[model samples]
Structure formats: structure tokens, C-alpha cells
Target: MLRQLRGWSYMYEKIFDGIREQAHVRDELRMGLVCDACDLGPCTFDGSTSRVPCGITPDEMAMKNLAEKIAEGLGEYKTHKRHITMVYDMESLLEAATRMVDVSRSYSDEIDKLLSPYRTVRTVPFGLGGLRPEAVNICAVSSPRGIHDLIEFTRTPEAAENIECAGAHGVNIVSLGYPGAELAYQRGIPCIGNYLVLDNALATGCIDAIHTFGSERASLEEALKHFASRKGPQCELPEPKMHTTGATLDVTAINRAYERGNIEGVVVLFGAASPTCSWHMEGLVTDLVEHGYLVLVTGAHMYEGSTDAMNAPGVVHIGFCEIGKMHGKGFAPTPFVLVPGWKNAKILTSTLALVHHGYPVITGVRIPLTPSIEEKLAEKGCITELNGERVVERISELQSHREG
Candidate 1:
């Protein structure tokens, strides 16, 4: 059986002020402020004495081997695309965290204390728009004005030059865009650059950090863990439900199940690809988030296959694009939370980085392509949403979403 684990989970206190805050009227923008340290999962201390024998062991040799394999595969299949690709996007997750930290930086004493631990947060602005028609704007902004500032601000040549510096220095650069994986394969850089919805994105080592920005949060399992970590024992959050599928969960069904006494918490079992579903289960995420359901979004190709290279020379970089888009529109998640997957090691590292850096993430794997491969992915806890004819035209429909 494949092993599984939760990365980071956060709990939020539903805090709303005044009659306007509680009103269900559509005009109210201040949804509510739910704050609490969600519980994060158990981390493998780089090299621990009591190491578990996962697919990618916690040893540097295993990690290096995996990285070498990925690098070698890219070299062996040097099929290049002519398009200028945008790699990763910071999205709403990063932005919200920055906002949280910024708020914490200014107000709360507890947050001020935590700020020292999160000094690695990126302050500079960056993007990949021009040249690539399909380029995605992958950036992070803390305040409401951050995104606005980024879009309106003029590019200083000095900052533009920093791309070279960032790349050269191996600063875990994230690329946000659709063609990110192809771009990474062509560039030979570990595609830890952008966030995509497919499983291959993870297994291929395309994104280093899978940014879960915007609103709809992780399952109760992850959120509770998140709460425990930052808040200590004073907070009692929900327990994590290890589902058969390797997807992040939502609380809707679990809440219902609780009412029916189906079980204590929710347990989700899922696979990634759907013959009926289209293009990497994009809006399906909305369902997962809205329904309060836990899902293993995909399979090994994305999550387990991703950080399998944890012991590589340097940390890998992953990118997320849409999370930022959703949050920038002024919609706050009803219950904000995040969690990382346990299928791979780098996920833990990335999750820790985001949490430490103030970014919240929902744990999940990317969708794989081949059926047999997807079957293997199922073993790793991925959830399958659509199948048959519906699955065939998924990507084409996905393109429509991009266009529409």
C-alpha cells in the first residue's frame, strides 16, 4: 500500500465585527476574519536516525538519484517547443500570507514575534507576461494594493536584470503559466517554476512550490494541523482524515457525515484524471473547496513524484497562478486553511517554507495522463473525477475556460 501524510493544516477563528459584518447581504465585502494557527503535519527532519523507508528515502543519495533521473529524461527527450513560456505564478496564497504577515507586522504582538521566523518572504515584484501570449502573471502581493501596484508599476531595468541574477544564484524561482512544464523541460532547469493542475507537473519536477493561494482552504485534517503548529496546545483543531484519494479535503461532507454519524471526520478517496472532466480539474477545485470534501486531486505524478528529489543539491521551486487571481478579486475563503501532501519530501519543505514565510497551501498531487500510469497514481491516493468520453476532451474545454 502507498504511504500518505498531511503537511500543513490551519484553523481559523470566525471573527466578524459590527452588524454589517454578520449581515448576509451581498453588498458586504468584509466577509469575516477567521484567525488561528492551523496544525501542520509531521515533518521528516532532513536526516533522522529513525527514517521510514518511503519511495524516496530521506537520504541525500536517493534524492540526488531522482533529480539525476529527471534531468536525464529531459536530456534524452530533448523535444523543444518554440514558444516563449511563462513558468510559475505566486497567486493568492502567497499574497494572502504576505497580507497576513503585513498585518501581523503592523498590529498584533504575537504576529510581530512570528515575523522574525518568516524573514525569507520575497518583497520584490516579478512576472512573465510579454513574449509568451499564454504567459501567466505569477506574483505575490500582501495588501489589496500589491497586485494593483504590480500591474500599474513600471518595470525598472534593474529589476528586469535581476531575473538573470535570480536564475544564476539558484534562487528558487517560480514560473507561473500553462506552458511552464514545457518551458522547464526545454530549459533543463528543474521546473520548480510554475503551478499546473496536472500530475505530471509534480513528477516532472516542474514546480518547486505548489502555491494554494486565494480562498477555499484545505480539508479539516490539514487545517487542524495548521492550527496546532502556530498556536500551540491552547487551540484544539480538527483531526486529519487520511483518505484513499490523495486530494486535499473540504468540510462540507464531513459536516454532513458528522450529523449522520457516518464517521468522526471526513475521509476522501480520489484519482486525478477524468475522461469526463476537463483540463486538470481546474474549477473542480472550487467544488472540493466549497463542498468541504477531502480529495487526492491526482496521483503520484504530481505530489509523490514531485518532491521525490528532496535530497537534490538545492530545493526545487513550484509555481501557482490562479490562487492569486481569486483573492485579488476581494473574496475571502469562508474557512481559510491549508495543508501539504506527504507523498513526497519536497512538499514538506515547500509547505514549511510557505508556512514559515506566511503562505498557506492546500496539499494535493497533479493529474497524470496515461491510464495505466493514472492507475498507478490511484495507488498513491489520487481521486478520479471523470472518465470515458468526457475525459477525452477535457483539455480542449480547459482552453475554453482560459479563453472565456
Candidate 2:
């Protein structure tokens, strides 16, 4: 009852337009970032009929050239490992795909080292004074509403406390599949599979060795059958409730969280899959946009990799729908965070997915398209937002040296 009352108070004090008025953020949230200075950049385009392709620097051009060479070396490594010496009849496709595959292998090798405590010296921090030194254990379950997942993990606050006591930094609950990617994005945690059909090989890091005995391969059907057989007819089990509406559930969860006054920020997860799901997700995005909520969509995931292997039409349709809505609303580009299981994490693919859809991702590296809308604001050296009639952040220069 207290929780519910608190939610009501939050709704009144923070969820309404008045909440925006009271906006305040901590100074620790800001960080000095190493500015990127890549040479040969890609062709630049504005939304209209303008194209500028020759602004790339010599260093950037040299880096791109070197990257292409490294790709060739990595392709040779893959050819040796896979025993496909004469498989490539054309050098062009091999050049492109091989470089990506090679870079991927090198990156994976690095992550494996980073995951180990002994390799601490080899680790480099990439964001905000380097990656925050934290390993977050996210206990998540997937059900119809997504709340079941959070509630299950936190059965009691004490139970949640136990995980924290065990050294978990933050908590993440993903009841629905769509939110998994976004939760992983905002929380900066890897998806450990609460309840959906996550790729078994990817989930377990058996992608390169699925045929080997060390990795177990099981289908959704096999899993259900195993569960049912364990029951042995003692009690009849009902059919699981199949959710045909992810978008609807997403909208419902957002509204509920807002009512609870727990939403400080939002990461929108909408894939261009299933026309029905896409339609609903797009609808939610539109609603959130009008309300000035920060929403990001991952439309390209709907059409990439294994995702594209299945629902091509659905993915394209969903991407187009999201694009249309964003264009119409003049909504800013927000990135779709990709939370594929570790070692098999498709961070680059996911980044490319959103870039393909023409939006900045929320949780990962911003795809270099337009200068980030945030960057646009930063051009003035500082920008301010109206919060309870107080200018925020912008006055820090003066406030830091206040006199009596």
C-alpha cells in the first residue's frame, strides 16, 4: 500500500509535466571524453540534396586502408581454420566480409581476456574514464508482462539484497523479450536469458563449436517436452500463454512504470518484426514522443543476421514504419541497444542495424550520422534546460566559483 501511495505521489510530483520542472541531475554524471579524431571519414550527406565526400583526413584514410589490409590477414586465418582454401571465387566479397570476421575474432579474443581478473592490466577503459569497474548480475525472467521477471528476482527486497550482498551492482528484470535489448542497453549489462528463445549457441558461446560435444543444442520444443515429461502426468499442465502483442505489452509497462514514478529515463525497444508487433511498438513510440519521453528504436535488428534469416518482410515493414513516424514527428535519432549473449554479442551488427535505420542508438556508440542532436546543443559550449525555473548544468561554470 505504501508503495502504491508512493507511486501516486510520484505521479503527481514527477510523472506530470511538473516533473520535468523539477529535473535535477548529479554532477558525477558528466565526464571528460577523449574526442574521436578519425581521418578518412565517410561521405557526408544532409537530408536534402547536398553531398560532401572529400573532407576525410589523411590519418583517417590511412586507418581505413590499414583496416582493409588487416581484414585480408584475418580472412586467411579463417580460411585455414575452416579448411576452405579455394572457397572464394571473388576477392571483393571476401575482402569485405573477411575483414569484418577477422576484426570480430580479434575483438572476441580481447573480451575473453577482459572477462578474466588476471588480465586487468591489458584492459583499457573506453567510456567515462574507461568502463565502470563493475560486474552487474541481472536476474531476469521473461513472462507475459515483464513485471513477473522483476518481481520474481526481488521476491522480497531481502532476496534482492542477497544478490547485491553477493556483489551484484544493479538489478535488471526483463519479463518481455523486446525490453531485453533495451534493458541491456541502459543498464549496460549482458542478457543472460530469463525466458525467451535466445540463441542457444550464442547464449552459451558455442557459435563456432555447435557441432562439437561441449555445447548442448536444444530447441524450444525440446525444452517444453523435457519439462512436461518431468511432471509425469501427476498434474495436468496448461498451455503457456503465447503473447501476440509485444508492442502492446511495452506500452502497458511504460505507462505502469510512469505511474510508479520509477522512470528517470527510457530506452525504447521496437524491432521491425511481426507487422502486428511493429504497429503496436510504433504506436507506443509515437505516444512517447508526443509526451517528450526519450525513446530509441532498433528497427534494423528486425532485418539483420539470424533475425533477417526469418522475418524479412516484417522487419522491413517495421523499420519503414518507425522511420515514417520519426520523420513525421521530427524525433531525434536514438540508438537501439543490442544485447546479444556474450562472446557472441553482436554489438557491431546491432550498431549497424540502427545506423541502417538512420537513428542514434541510446545505449551504445552513437552511429556517426548527423552530429548527435546533443552535440548540436553542445556547440554553444553549454546548453540549459528549464527545470523548476532553474537553469541546469549551464551555470556550473559560475556556480563552481560562487562568491559571498
Candidate 3:
């Protein structure tokens, strides 16, 4: 994918590398204990030096910082959910809710039994009572509204796979949003990763049609100009060498997989922002699959092109938001692990949400949690700060528990 884009002088790899390098530099600067309250010298939080010049203890400062980060992460997701809700009419909104309920009901008895614990019916309008209002709102509002003429892209592997399959069946596929271009590449389908890529993809004459959603409309006119200007010979892009032939799993397939005992466990790979981390996760996922685990991935992990991982008998590519909804209803009957490559706020919040829902989540990233939050998670048997080896160890135990 990088090589093909490079032909058009699109420096996506260079830009991403620059961003990652800057992020590392920022992390280095944050290592010092700098007091944000006042213009004071950088203070070291040794046991002897308990308090900073601002009259706050090191523990207090840490807790405050953690709280702010959590708030920021939660706010981002909430705002995204609100934006989806604001765009659709009430009739369309209710139709989405009804569809979800109908889908849930169509499951087999075994699948239904597995979903009963987390199945939400209430707060869905004309359903049984006792569903989480927030969950229902999120699921309903975020549901796809109308039939898309162009390929409406998002941050999900399933979306890319669907687009590719549709295109193969004689449908016009064009990207409208950010990310998942790599996943599309696996199937030999061209897709845009972001607005910049959208411009380039259109200019290359690879995209058949374009559709903009949300704030993407702001750059529509400029993108169209680029699309219109490039009418010369089209470039023949190289196909990815290691393509996986696995089908993307939907909600019904997910339930059926669980009921059939085809999925032993699930491992979510986060923080695909950096090339190095993404490479590491690709290897890790392959290892997990070899050990008979059903590897699940979202975000940039979808584009890693780990053929071995995908070909592993039980691999499933899904969206992060879809997994969050599935968590509410006990999707993984066995234990699962959440692997994070970086200290990302969104990943932290998603991990917390899963832990809050009583899933046996083993976290790979070390998130700074308040004592209360840590204790609650501990009570639920959620472990954090596990390295790759320890994570696999925990998964082995969980698999054993399932078999026993």
C-alpha cells in the first residue's frame, strides 16, 4: 500500500513516521515531574520529596492527571455518538432500534442463551424493560442509516471487507471517511485512509464514486477538483502479496461462532498508530491464532496484512464500537485479553468500559487508575500491566477453565 501511494508522491509513510517520532519526543519531555499549578522548578517525586511547590502530593497530582485523561477520552466517544444521533430523523432512529432487537431474537437457542446475560431489550422503545439507556442510545444512533451509493468507510475491518466484496460483485466502491484502507488493500480493493489520501485516490482514478459524511463535507469541493483534473492514464497498483481469504464476521456470525464453540477466546489489538507497533501486533496475533485463540482486531490493526493471523482458523475482523456493544451481552463466553501498544486515551476508556461490564480483561498497557477504580477492577479479576508472555499465559488459563 505504501509503495503504491509513493508512486503518486503521496508521503503517507513519511508523515506517519514523523508523527510517531514527535509523539516519542513528547513522551520524553513528560517524564519530569513538572508542577502545572505554578511557575516552579521541575520537582522529583522521591519518597523524601513527598510534596511539590504547589502544595499537592505526588499521588494527588497523579490522580488528578489520570482523572482528566479519562474524562477527555470518555468525552470524545460521547461526542462522536451525539454527532451520529443528531444527523438522523426519529423514524430512521426507531427503525435501527427495531432492527437490532429483531436480529437478537433471530439467534438460535444456544446463541440466545449465550446472549441472554448481556442482551438489552429495554430503553429500545416497545421492548422489554431493563436495558442500559446509554448502550441502547449508542447502538441505535450509530447504526447505518440509508443504502450508500459510494463506499462509506469507517474505522472497521468489516466495513472494508464488505466494500471489497460488494465491489467484486459489480458494485461501485469509493471511500468517504478515514482509515481501513489497508484492509481494503488485502482484498485488492483501493481505498482512501484520510482526506489527503482521498484526494490522491480520486486523482489516481482508483475511486469510482465519492461520498462525504460528517465533517468530511467541508473538503468535498476541493477533493472534487482534484478528481476532475486527473483524467489521464490510470496507474495499475500492485496487489498485496499476502492476502487472507477469510470472510468478515457480522453479529449473527459472531453469535454462531460462540455457540458452536469455534471461538475459544478473543484478543483485541489497539494502538496501530505506529508502524513498529503494528508489525509487533501482527506477529503477536499470528502467535495467538496458532495457540487456538480466535483473534479479533479493529482500527489500524485491520490493515496490518497479517495473512497468517487472518488465515488462522478462528480469526474475526470487527469494529471497535461493535465489540463494545457485544461486550454488553457476553460475546466471549470464555475469557479475553485487551492488548494495547501505546498509552492511548480511547483504548484506556474502552478497556475500562469492558472491565466495568465484568469481562475477564487482561490489559497490556499500564494505565494510571485511581485506587477506587483499580480496586473495582481487581474485584472483577481484571489484571493490568501484563506483558505479551503473561497475557498469553492468562489466556491459556482461561482456555483451560473453559474446557474444564
Against the reference, the lDDT scores of all candidates come to: 0.27, 0.30, 0.40
lDDT tens digits, residue span 80-181, model 1: 232112212223322222433333224323322332232221211112211111111122212222322232221345434442333321222222332232
All candidates: TM-score:
0.20, 0.22, 0.44
State model 2's lDDT.
0.30
Off by over 4 Å in 2: 1-229, 232-345, 352-358, 364-404
User: Residue-wise lDDT of candidate 2 within 1-404, one digit each (tens)?
Assistant: 99999989977876566545533321111211111222112232222323322334444545655665576578677655553334433223223333344453454344323332321111111111211113221223331124223433344565546545544333323221333333332222222222223332123221111111111122222322332333222322222211111121133444444455443233344332221111233343444333333343332222111111111111111111122222223222232222111111133333333333333232212323345644542332222222211221223222343221
lDDT of 3: 0.40
The best-first sequence of candidates by TM-score reads 3, 2, 1
Task: In model 1, state the lDDT of residue 257.
Answer: 45
**RMSD of each candidate?**
26.3, 25.8, 20.1
Could you tell me which residue pairs clash in candidate 3?
Answer: 118-329
- Top model number, lDDT: 3
User: Which 10-residue span in candidate 1 carries the lowest summed lDDT?
Assistant: 128-137
Give the Å error, residue 96, model 2. 7.5
Return model 2's CA RMSD, one decimal.
25.8
Pitting candidate 1 against candidate 2, the one with the higher lDDT is 2
User: Residues 306-400, candidate 3, lDDT per residue (tens digit)?
Assistant: 33233233545432222332444445353374544332333444444555544567655434556776665556556664455556777676557
